[model samples]
Target chain A: MSIWEYANPKKFMQTSGLLLPWVTGLAAIALVVGLIWGFFFTPADYRQGATVKIIFLHVPAALMAINGWLMMLVASLIWLIRRHHVSALSAKAAAPIGMTMTLIALVTGAIWGQPMWGTWWAWDPRLTSFMILFLFYLGYIALWHAIEDPDTAADLTSVLCMVGSVFAILSRYAVLFWNQGLHQGASLSMDKTQHISNVFWFPLIVCMGGFVLLFVALLLLRTRTEIRARRLQALLLRERMA
Target chain B: MLPELGKYAATVLGAYALAILLIVGLVVLSLRQATRMRDRLRDVEERVKE
Candidate 1:
């Protein structure tokens, strides 16, 4: 069957309901194992010391924060093009989760930076762009609530999502574009020389996997709730009309 | 037993605490909303049938 068939609400619900338990279980396992490994078993950095452990949460949260927005951007695009309610609701469902990720990243980054950089905050390009991304998330969520009509809210937020995507891209690559930032270069990169050492790398990869799985599980759950809420609204409206 | 975190014990622990708190809060809120929506939808569906 074509992928679009799942765009239908019933099919989407059926598949997601079956998938949710498995995804949630895997996410929990990965997160528990990864965090315990990173926190208790990993060696401290010579320079950064135990503060290095914060990387487990910071990097993964930062990655998901950006990726969550990208997911919403794609969903928004689909809604704009295909006029699928599921796509629109999915975008709506993703915003708060993205915002929380962004908040986690920022807070953890600040805590890590306090010792490493001798400061808790900076206007460095990467940090600044991430802050902007957080604001975009807030604006996107606020726009949804402000509009009473679902379709109109979806339309406006889709446009907003498109506009905010530029900043998201900027946030993702600001380190590359600006070399002078206090923020360090990527921990995981294609260049082996630039990559973090294997000692810390393995558990980090696991943590990243956990974060991704967690995002998927949360997205499915939230999207199903949004769909149900929409259906309830429709049923109430029908009853009123009758 | 906790790993020896040196002078940054507070810092490391604080970050983990905050992050975990936020994540748990988000999960609880989402689950609560999902349950509420599910129950409301079921009730409406039942009333409509009646």
Candidate 2:
């Protein structure tokens, strides 16, 4: 059947409920194995030492933080175009998870930066753009809570998501835009010359996988909750009318 | 039991602790909200049936 069929809330709920347990279990396994491998099994960097371990969390979280917004951006567009309630609620469900990922990335980056850069904070292009991304997430979430009408809130936030996507794109490419940033180039890149060594790369890939699965699991759970809440509101309204 | 993190022990540990705390907090909040919503919807559905 066409993918749009799942856009129906009941079908969405049925599919997600079946998928959630498997996704959650895999996420847990990948995260545990990856973190344990990175923290305890891997060798320390000659220059960065144990602080290098922080990369395991920082990079994955940073990746998810940006990707989560992109996911919302796509969901928001679908809602705007298709007028699907599931799409709007999915976007709403993703915001807090994205916010948390951004927070983890920023905090871990700062902690890692202290020793490597001899500073806890910087206005460097990459860091600055990421900061703006974090603020956009805050604004997106706040807008949802502030508006009482779901459709209106979804409409406004979808527009906001489109506006904020510019900054999200900036956050990802700021290093290429301005070369003077204290932040280094990408940790994982498609370019073979720029790629991290396999010693650290393998576990990192696993951690990234874990983070992706975790985001999906959380998104499904939260979206289901939002759907249920919407149904409850509808039922109550019907009761009042009756 | 643990790798020797050298002088960065506090730094590395602190980052892990904070990240884990935030993730766990998010998970707990999500699960709690899901349960509450599920229960409330079930109750409303039951009352409507009655």
Candidate 3:
């Protein structure tokens, strides 16, 4: 079937049903492999010791946290302009996953920081902006629950998603913008003039790719659930009217 | 049990355990939620058919 065919809710659900197990299996495998490879095989940083190993989890989750929000922002914009119900639901579905990733990043970050930076928390721009991004996630999830009208909720939340994206962008680049930071400079940046060793960089790329797939699997499952919920709600409302 | 865990290793192990626990919790909760929604929708649909 063409990619567009899955745009229909029933078709989407069918596709998800087939895809879910494979995605789930892949996620479990990749996560296990990545963690094992990171902890045991990868050499410890000479300076940071075993503690720098947190990068395997911290970096990937942090990257996903930002990218997930960007996905929601784009989906929200599409939904608003095109009035696509699926697009709105996709945005809503992504919120919790994004929020979880953000929290993962924050906690792992603190753990990494305590040993290295000699503190559990700091008001550095990178950390501060991430905290704000977490708040935006909370606000988005709360808005979804608070509004009784789905259409209204979608519209308002989409607008908020657009407005709030600035902070998500800031969270990514805050280190570069300012001179002061305990945080190491970006290991990966748009300007690829500086290159990292293949040993570290290669696995990092694999983990990142694994994370992206994991996110896709999660978002698709969540979106399917959301569509089912709206369908049930519609059915109940119709029954009441009858 | 590793020897060094008495001091700094405790924090490191604790942090990893906490992260793994939280991730497991999140995945379980998400799966439960998705299942509930799907089942509820199916139930409602069956009722309408009746």
Candidate 4:
């Protein structure tokens, strides 16, 4: 059976329905454990002090915010190239989740920065690009509602996703292209020297895993709902025609 | 037991609380919406079939 078989809506519903509970359960456990460990057990950072704890939430949410958009970009490309309805619907399903992730990161970042940077807001390149990313999400959602034709909306949103990718890249790498602002360089990297110290690393990784699983479970649930809506629309159209 | 979070205790706790609120809220809302959508779809399908 090809992987694309799961793209069939019925197959998808069955598979994702089975998988959702397990994924959600794992996410809950991991998130709870990671946050507890990071907040209670981990020592305060020497440089930043107690507020360093916010990284547990802020970093993971930030990472998901970017990665979620990247996922939509890929799904959009798949939909455009392959004409897979499920792929398009999956992209639609992911937007709100991605938007929420972006908001969480922005708010948490501001809170963390207030104590560390001594200011709540700045026109830093990273911050500005993230705000742009948020706008892209809102515009994408708006496009979906503005267009009544599902296929046309999918086409337009697919194009929007492609365009938004450039801004997402700018958002992610703005720290590198411009001078680094209040945001720190990526501490987590494939390079061994750049990996975060173990005290913070373990729970951070766990928390990130939890966030990813949460994203997956939610995406599946939302996608299933979208598919059902589409089916209902089709049936109604048929009834009208008959 | 809550550990001493120094002067930033409120801020730290607030951040966590907000994250929890948002994440849990999303999960609950999404699940409820899905269930409702499923029910509505079933009803429409039945009507369309009839």
Q: Give per-residue CA lDDT, model 1, range A42-135, as digits (tens).
A: 9889999999999999999999999999999999999999999999999999999999999999999999998899999999999999999999
Q: Mark the 10 consecutive residues where model 3 chain A has the least summed lDDT.
A: A189-198
- CA error at residue B47 for candidate 4, angstroms: 2.3
Worst window of 10 by summed lDDT in candidate 4 chain A: A180-189
The TM-scores, one per candidate, come to 0.99, 0.99, 0.92, 0.97
Tell me, by DockQ, which candidate is best.
Answer: 2
3 versus 4: better TM-score goes to = 4
User: What is residue A201's positional error in candidate 1, in angstroms?
Assistant: 0.6
Model 4 stretches with alpha carbons more than 4 Å out: none
TM-score of the first chain alone, every candidate: 0.99, 0.99, 0.94, 0.97
* Model 1 DockQ (Cα-based): 0.93
Candidate 4 local Cα displacement, residue A180, angstroms: 4.6
Give the chain B TM-score achieved by candidate 2: 0.98
lDDT tens string, model 2, A1-242? 99999899999999999999999999999999999999998888998999999999999999999999999999999999999999999999999999999999999999999989999999999999999999999999999999999999999999999999998889898988799999998888898778888989999999999999999999999999999999999999999999
The TM-score between candidate 1 and the true structure equals 0.99
Model 4 chain B weakest lDDT span, ten residues long: B41-50
Between candidates 1 and 4, the DockQ winner? 1
Q: Score candidate 2 by lDDT.
A: 0.96
Runs of candidate 1 with Cα error greater than 4 angstroms are none
By lDDT rank, best first, the candidates go 1, 2, 4, 3
